[model samples]
Target chain A: TQLLEQSPQFLSIQEGENLTVYCNSSSVFSSLQWYRQEPGEGPVLLVTVVTGGEVKKLKRLTFQFGDARKDSSLHITAAQPGDTGLYLCAGGGVNAGGTSYGKLTFGQGTILTVHP
Target chain B: NAGVTQTPKFRILKIGQSMTLQCTQDMNHNYMYWYRQDPGMGLKLIYYSVGAGITDKGEVPNGYNVSRSTTEDFPLRLELAAPSQTSVYFCASSYSASGRAYEQYFGPGTRLTVT
Candidate 1:
C-alpha cells in the first residue's frame, strides 16, 4: 500500500482558474515536503511543512499541513500555464540523531496541466 | 558544484545482463539515495547510504545492490537484468546536520530499459 495518497491523478484547467491538490495519509510524519517536476527532469523541492496546521504561501500557491500532520493541501489561485507540472508529496519520520536516513515515502503524484 | 551527477543518461540492457548505475555528488553531503520511478507513479526508494562504508536498504531493495566506498560515490548494481526493472532511476543527496536536514539535490536521471 502507498504510505501517502494523492488525489486527482491528473488535472487540466484553463489559465486563471483556481485549483487544489490533496495529499493524505494514515501515518503521521515528522516532516512533509512538496515538489514540482517538469517533463524529463527530476522533481524540485517546493515547500517543507513540519508543524501541524501550518500554512505556507508561495506567491500564487498556498500549502497547508493538516492539524493531524497526516494530510496536506496545495491551492493555487489564478493559475498560469507556467504552473503546469507534476506535484509530489513526500513524508518521513524523524531519526534519533535528528537526521532522517533519506528514505522518504512519496505519493503517486498529480500531473497538473494549465492551458493558456 | 556539480551537485549530484549520474552517468549513462540512458542504457538498454538485455535479459540476464549485468551493469552498474553510477552516482556521484560534489556537495559533500552525508546522505545519498537511489530511487526508481515507474511510469505515472511516485519514486520508490531502493537503497541509501548514510556515509562512506555505511549502506542500508529501502522499501524496494530487491534485485539491486549498492556499495558506498567513498562519501562522494554510491553505485547501484543489478546482477541480472529483467523487464520488470526497466524504469527511470534518480540519485539524490542531502546534507543532514544536528536537528536540521537540507533538501535533496537530484541528478538529470538515468533511463534504463531491460528487455
Candidate 2:
C-alpha cells in the first residue's frame, strides 16, 4: 500500500509566523496535490505539483515536490489567522493496469492554528 | 455550476439500518469518487466510478456499495449502519484527459452518525 506520512499533525503559531508541513512516502507517485480545509467544509485544492523538484508559489504559500516523487512539502510565509486550517497532501497515481485514472492516497493532514 | 452536491447534510442512524448518500455533479465530470473521513484523520476512498455504469471498490469499501446509472450521479449505499460507520462523507468529481494533471472538485460533505 502506498502511504503518505505527514509530520507535526498539530501546529499552533502566532500570526506572521512561518511554518512548513512535510509529506513523505517510500512509493513514487505521478503527481501530488495540496489542499486546505476549514471546519465543517470539504477540503479545497491549493495546488498540484507533478514535475520532480518543481516549485510553485501562491502569494504567501510555497509548494515543492521531491525530486524522487516520493515526497512533497508546503511552506507558508507570514501566516495569518485566516491561514489556519487543515492542510492535506495527496499523492496521485494510476493503477498499474492503467484501469483507474487519477487515484489519490491522502496523508493524515496537518492542523494549523494561527493565533492572532 | 453546482460543482458536486451531496444530500442530507447530517443524518443519524441506528444499527442495522440502511441509507443511501446522494452525490451529483453538474460539470459532467467523467470521474466520481466517494470518500469517508473519520475524526482527526484523512479522507479514505470507499468507491469510485470512471464513468456511467463503471464502478470499483477503493481502499475501504467494506459494508458499502455504489452505483452510477447516469453520468452525473453516483450514490453510496450503506447496508448496515455501525458505530464505526460514523464519519463525514465527501463526494468528488474530476475530468481527466491524456496525462495532464486534473483537479478534483469536492462537495460540502455529509456528516453521518450511527448509534
Candidate 3:
C-alpha cells in the first residue's frame, strides 16, 4: 500500500508567521496534490504537482514536488487566519496492470491554526 | 454550475439501520468518488465510478456500497450502520481527456453519526 506521512500533525501560530508542512512517502507517485479543508467542509484543491522538482505558487502559498516524486511540501508566507485549516497531501498512481486510471492515497493531514 | 452536490448534510443512525447518501454532479464528469474523513485523518476512498454502470471498491469499502445508475448520480449505501461508520463523507468528481491528469472537485460533505 502507498502511504504518505505528514509531519507536525498540529500547528499553531500567530498571524504573519511563516511555516512549512512536509509530506513524505516510501513509494513513488506519478503526481501529488495539496488540499485545504475547513471544519464542516470537504477539502478544496490547492494545487497539483505532476513533474518532480516542480514548484507552483498560489498567492502566498508555495507547493513543491520532490525530485524523486516520493515527497512534497507546502510553504506559507506571512500566514493569516484565513490560512488556518487542515492541509492534506495525496499521492496518485496507476494500478499494477496499468490499465486503469490511478486513485489518490492521502496522508493523515496537518491541522494549522493561525491566530490573528 | 452547481459543481458536486451531496444530500442529507447531516444524519444520525442507530445500529443495524441502513442509509443512503446521495451525490450528483452537473459537470458531465466521468469520474466520481466517495470518501470518508475521520477526526484528524485524511479522506479515504470508499468507492468510485468511472462512468455510469461501472463502479469499483476503494480503500475503505467494507461497510459501504455504491451504484452509478446515471451519469450524474452516485449514491453510497450503508447496510447496518455501526459506530465505526460515523464520519464526514465527501463526494467528488473529475474529468480528463485521458483520465490521467485530472483534478477532483468536491462537495460540501455529509456528516454521519451512528450510535
Backbone clash count, each prediction separately: 0, 0, 0
Worst 10 residues of 1 chain B by lDDT: B95-104
Per-residue lDDT over B42-64 for candidate 3, one digit per residue giving the tens place of the 0 to 100 score: 88999998899999999899999
Q: Write the per-residue lDDT of candidate 1 for residues B1-115, one digit (tens) a residue.
A: 7778998899999999999999999988988999999977899999999899999988899999999999999999998999999999999998643243346778879999999
DockQ list for all candidates: 0.64, 0.66, 0.60
lDDT of 3 by residue, A22-116 (tens): 99999988788999998888788899888889999999999999999999999999999999999999987853454445578889999999999
Badly placed stretches (over 4 Å) of model 2 are A94-98, B97-100
> Chain B, TM-score, each prediction?
0.95, 0.96, 0.96
User: Which lDDT value does model 2 have at A79?
Assistant: 95
In model 3, the runs with Cα more than 4 Å from the true position are A95-102, B97-99
lDDT of 2 at A2: 92
**Per-residue lDDT for B1-115 in model 2, tens only?**
7789999899999999999999999999989999999866899999999999999999999999999999999999999899999999999998764464557889999999999
* C-alpha positional error of residue B80 in candidate 2 after TM-score superposition, expressed in Å: 1.4
Q: Write the per-residue lDDT of candidate 2 for residues A55-116, one digit (tens) a residue.
A: 99999999999999999999999999999999999988844655547778999999999999
Model 1: what TM-score? 0.95
User: What is the TM-score of each predicted model, taking all chains together?
Assistant: 0.95, 0.97, 0.96
